[model samples]
Target: MKLSDLIAQFITDQLTGQDAVELQRSQLASRFGCAPSQINYVIETRFSPARGFSVESRRGGGGYIRIVRVPMGPSALLQHTVAALGEQVDQSGAQLLLYDLHKAGILGDECFCALKACLGDQALSAVPQPLRPRLRAEMLGAALAALAAEQ
Candidate 1:
């Protein structure tokens, strides 16, 4: 593995439980003798849904980067959901799925809120429209998986 890849693995290894929170990207970059952007690149390229991992980032001071490993069951579900999303997702179907997940207690209120924010019509009204549904699905799936793994 490359140095950055090894460093990323080490960081991932350190996250043992759900309560394990975000890691400082700058700190990780310094530890690996790389730029912060390099760390971001590594995360974007290597820690992806297909690889069974998801990453969340924040900007500005005290910001952090979170990497969550998706459990096998949810990972499979997410894969299937992504495949099923195809080009677009009807709003009603997305809402229904979200409702089902919320009802099942698989997604908590906070997660539900975040997912809604991402999938809300206003948030998705932008260029490259075809990508929104798939992105929302992927984000919701990852967020749910993270919540499940954490609990």
Candidate 2:
């Protein structure tokens, strides 16, 4: 497993029967044999709002990082995914979000395949480099908005 996955799993394991886990970043980094920034990277990429987790950090001698698992319903999950897409999305991120929606039963296999194709690199490659992400986001947003409306 990747270091980030390991860190995320470690934090998840700490959340047994709890809403949140609070720990010192430096301490986690030391335990993982990595820099503090690696901890931050894991928190940012893995424990994001889109992934149903919230992260709060304090910086100081007594600083600590807190990770909370957010309970989200179907509508709220779709909303968070849309918001996370923002104004741009790369193929990989788009694919991941679509997979999440699929796993949540918000999307069927047909819809998943369609959205995946629309957001794939091959489809977006026809667009200019600078504008590809935005175009992908717009297409994805339209599709997700339609899904949200159906909900």
Candidate 3:
């Protein structure tokens, strides 16, 4: 695993069986033998709302970062995924989002594969290259929103 992945896993382990965990950046940085910015990078990317986490930080008195795992049902995950989609998404980005949703047990095997196929380049062939990514984002957001509505 990469250093970032290790750091992410460590933080995750710390949160196991708990709703939230707090840590000092300097301590985590020293433990990981990296800079505090490195810890920040992991927390920012791996513990984002899209991944079902919310982080809060304090800036004084040897500040600490609090990571809270957001409790979410399948519908909630679907809704969050849709909201996380920005104005555009490449094929890989859509795949990663779908994979995350699937791994969370919100999407079954059939649904995951089907969604991935639809988001692939071939599926969007009719869309001009320049417009494909934006179209994919719109398509995905709409699909997820529709699913969320049903749930």
Instruction: Using TM-score, give the best candidate's number.
Output: 2
Compose the digit string of candidate 2's lDDT tens values, residues 1-151.
9888899889889988999999999999999999999999888667765577767899989999988888987677677667767798888878877876787688899999999997898877778889989899999988887787778
Residue 50, model 1: Cα distance from true site in angstroms: 1.4
Q: In terms of lDDT, which candidate is strongest?
A: 3
In candidate 1, what are the lDDT values of residues 1-151, reduced to their tens digit? Answer: 8987787677767766663447898888888888898888777555554445666789788889887776555546455445434454545546655665565455679876777667776777883667766666666556655655565
- In model 3, state the lDDT of residue 149: 90
Q: Which parts of model 3 are misplaced by more than 4 Å?
A: 14-45, 48-50, 54-67
Q: What pairs collide in candidate 3?
A: none
Clash count per candidate: 0, 0, 0
lDDT (0-100) at residue 114 of candidate 2?
A: 90
- As for candidate 2, its clashing pairs are none
Q: Which has the better TM-score: candidate 2, or candidate 3?
A: 2
lDDT tens digits, residue span 31-111, model 3: 989998999989866886557887889977679999998889778877876776779999987887788778777778998
> Looking at candidate 1, what is the lDDT of residue 96?
58
Give the lDDT of residue 143 in candidate 2: 83
